[model samples]
Target: MTKFADIKGFVFDLDGVITDTSILHGTAWHQLADSLGVTWTKELGDGLKGISRMDSLEMILKAGHKENDYTQAQKEELAAQKNTNYVAEVDKMTPANILPGMKAFLDDLRAKGYQLSLASASKNAPRVLGKLGLTDYFPKIVDPASLKHGKPDPEIYTKGAELLNLDPAQCIGLEDAAAGVQAINGAGETSLGIGDATELGAADMVFADTSAVTLANIAKHLD
Candidate 1:
């Protein structure tokens, strides 16, 4: 574990990595698209992952060929409505909603004294964590509102390391989205992707799911 010795913290992305909120997010965006008379597609839904709410809205608008149709204030109103829809579902989350093996993995990380911080683009990260009874696991959560840039720009992960008082080199970033893995790599942290190997090939390591993200398994890849 010599190569892992310097690792002091873990920065996590909340959506697919921590739990599955894609349905909630998709439903919200789908409803908004329908209201605006825009057609929704699977490809459009996939593009929203690991991105900020505003960015997601813009993407949806572009997909509908209505990018210039809404004023800035109107766009904000639409985004807010989308959030309202997402939050209604998020409020229903419970500990049971925590992904399989994730609680055990978090417990292992904590027992080993590895600091944890969240770098989710979602503004509702705290509420989701609270609902899932996992708020205390992450002492620091980078507020998306404070960032000038989102995932794949490195700002969020860099700030997460900063909040832990650690250098990017001393942290491992866990994510399940391509943009998030890019953000981790861009931040100079060890990147671990928790999904399909082909989609996440850029990461330093890839796990099929949370069940395989054990500390021992992580040690093997750190070297």
Candidate 2:
């Protein structure tokens, strides 16, 4: 396997990776399922990895029944509800929910002269980072609001590279979703899949979770 030690920086996906919000996402998604009279199975939920909440909603509509679909307005409404519920859930997420080892990893990467940034499909990325005191770790944040499309399009990942003034191939993207992995792959960058390993088997490599993404692992990737 080709090691990507030559990469100059690291980009991260929020929510599941940094904020431990996957369960909350599932909660909101299952809520939508209830309203639609469909069940949000774990496998179906895992399939939504790396996709934006809006995209996930679209997927949910299809996964729920494939016949009943979400209109643009309803899509917006579902996204809004998820955001609302997520914020409320994390309003209490002071230091507990932030993944273990994230701070140390960020510090080590910054110390290693690697530029750090974030690319999340979540619309409330800025706010979520602020709540966890993680905003200072990454100055550049690419979210759904800044793009015409979400994950699996590479636009967000490409935009993050643009903001960093780096080429996509020169960076590594840390993501927890299948969509996130696909996005970085489409962007032509080295993608290190984090969060749930089963859902990210298609990635170049799958770590146990954010806690497993250490400087040691980063060093291994450094060519």
Candidate 3:
């Protein structure tokens, strides 16, 4: 009964999938690390993808050998501050910030009556979508505050499918990170990775970037 053609919903990860907000996230984390005298590295920032804010902070603290240096309250404050820094940059985004081909892809999906949902770990997903003029595309965004687990756990993707009133088997999930691909796969959705095939081998399909993620190509594969 679960035909591949039954894919009627899409669960999207906001950051690299719809747009490139990694630099903004990096800037925010770097600013926080500097304020705490913690050395920041690109690798650390890269590892933060598809994870929750607090988890990212924990990784940063461990990297700087400062994991035990802060109380829970202090850590929460630091996370809030980093969000403040990130939001400052997010506020500058516009529809032009949407990745090439992504808007067209979303339009095609919508025109076909496919439902869309957001499964980003960022609490700022709605705001970022708004800035990118994509708020109307995804009426259902899994609230990060409502989740107990982050990507690689499947909870967010499952919740996204639930919000779309579809089974995970009836959805295709797009992601740009390994953890996100894993989450989609774990939720039983066909996973499309917007990155190198070697890096995202677990995905059901891989595209070099958003430009390559066309509905036609996906339909070709599904056929």
Candidate 4:
């Protein structure tokens, strides 16, 4: 068992965990698919969560039967276009875009002396954090540009721990996606899932939402 007090750092996922920008991302993806004449569905949008933009675009291309039609450069261009759309949406974000209880939870953790880092698959993570007025809260931000591989690869989470100068075992990774939970566990850190239990079964512990996350609940892991 690991105690919250024993945790030296906290790594958070940006999109679903810190904010509800997943919908904006999905909208961008859907719009991209529409322009490409590809059929898009909610199920496909779910697959994009926690994945890198290039990977998501690959998935979309494969689903659209255009994987072989585009060269790597073309794919990159399409991915960039998707990012432009997503960024347009994110630019409109404000502090109110942060999820319920997230600000207070982060403040509480900071007060307790826990180092914080943001490990997000989004290249726009810094922009989003700035829009939410949370840029100062995380001194270490491992975004898509910093990652060679995305979630479920564990590189991002491990990099986050490295940036905090803490061992993976000394950190707690908080996420709201199944792939992210797997990445956290794969990094040898404690996993705190922030969504559906069944969806995030790989997590060491699960909370239904940010409001359910508390120092006491996390400390109980020490037992």
Candidate 5:
């Protein structure tokens, strides 16, 4: 068994991991770019990975050649509006898109008595989770306001470990973003990378996506 404090507790990232909202985010950025007359593409939007909504706006605006024009509050408003648009677009996502294996894995962990928490950079994370009806799965959610720093900086992961009352070494972090993977490692927990290999490189081990993630794989790390 894993020796990490509350070896049963799990910290999961929201965007690319638990929900398929990244695509929505990409579409929103693309829409923003179009309105701003900027060139937007998947590659251009890729850098938004594991970032806050406000930061994403700043980045997108920078790409639009108006970086200095958007003030802090304006950025916040745009980010919020972008979130609104993104959510409306994603309202179509059903149980069909919450990733094929995530529910089963979470249920299995719950059966084993593990505490589950959500760590996400999105300020709109609560709404996202609420929309998906996944609010109950994570009683402990560490949102952007919960910490002074975001992913790749590790404050979120560190806060999750603290909230779970577990040693950093014993906790495990799951993320699909390169920045989040770095945050997990920075927080001193075993990082479980999902999706891209670059993100997984920061992890002690990796899964291609939620479908590839399994309780068995988690057990391997704990062992």
Candidate 6:
């Protein structure tokens, strides 16, 4: 089995993996949809996971059958408005909001001399990290604004590896979204899915949730 000892760096997805801000994002989306008189559902919220804000807005628009109704500027405005709501929710976050075992796991990785980076589609990654008191754990944050494409594109994960000065194969990527798992796999790295196995079949291994993921379990995947 591959051991955690073999992994030189760790690349993490922010929202669902490191924290539970997915609900806040979903709530913002619902508010936006409600304002537009569009019926938003939990199924649609699932689609927004690991995707960019503009893309999520586009999906909402498409779902509402109003995709072409808005100009590019209008779409940008709508995305910004939703971000305002999401940011407000984020501002209320505390370190306690971080997933169980996450802080300790990060500490363990740091003590083992592994570099860490965050590769998230959220433009507010830094803000969220700051809110959760996790900004210090990740030295390298792959900015969403720097990427031309989002999750499922491999660009973010690849960039994360680059920032950590490690090869993709030498890094372990953790995510709670299928698109993120696909992106990690596409980048030729090992993927540890942090959610339901059925939703993350592309991952090399799956954990039921962040609380279930342990350093020992990560090491087992290194093989």
How does each model score on lDDT? 0.91, 0.77, 0.91, 0.89, 0.78, 0.87
The regions of model 5 sitting more than 4 angstroms off are 1-6, 50-80
Name the runs in model 6 displaced over 4 angstroms: 1-3, 37-52, 58-72
Against the correct fold, how does model 6 do in TM-score?
0.86
> What value of lDDT does candidate 3 attain over all alpha carbons?
0.91
- For candidate 5, the per-residue lDDT at 136 reads 82
As a whole number from 0 to 100, the lDDT of residue 90 in candidate 1 is 93
Once fitted onto the true fold, the runs of candidate 2 whose alpha carbons sit more than 4 angstroms away are 1-5, 28-82, 195-199, 221-223
In order, what is each prediction's RMSD in angstroms? Answer: 2.5, 4.0, 2.4, 2.4, 3.0, 2.5
What is the TM-score of each predicted model, taking all chains together?
Answer: 0.87, 0.75, 0.87, 0.86, 0.82, 0.86
Please report how far candidate 2 places residue 187 from its true position, in Å.
1.2
Candidate 1 lDDT, tens digit per residue, 1-223? 2278888899999988788998889988999999999899999998886567899999999988999999999999999999998999999989999888999999999998999999988778999999999999987999998999877899999999999999899999999988889999999999999999999999999999988888889888876
lDDT of 3 at 210: 95
Per-residue lDDT of 1-223 in model 2, one digit per residue for the tens? 4456667878888866777777777776777677777776889878775455667877877776653565678778777887777678767667566888887788888887888888876666777788788877888887566689777889988988887899888888888778889999999888888857688877876778677888677656555
**Which candidate leads the pack in TM-score?**
3
Residues 1-223 of candidate 3 have per-residue lDDT tens digits of 3445788999999888899998898899999999989898878888986566899899999999999999999999999999999999999999999999999999999999999999988778899999999999989999998998877999999999999999899999999988889999999999999988898999988999899988889877777
Clashes of each: 0, 5, 0, 0, 1, 4
Candidate 2 TM-score versus the reference: 0.75
lDDT of 4 by residue, 1-223 (tens): 6666678999999877889998898989999999999998878988887577889999998998889999999989999999899999999999999899889899998998889999887667888899999989988998567567766999999999999999999999999889889999999999999989999998999999988887887887556
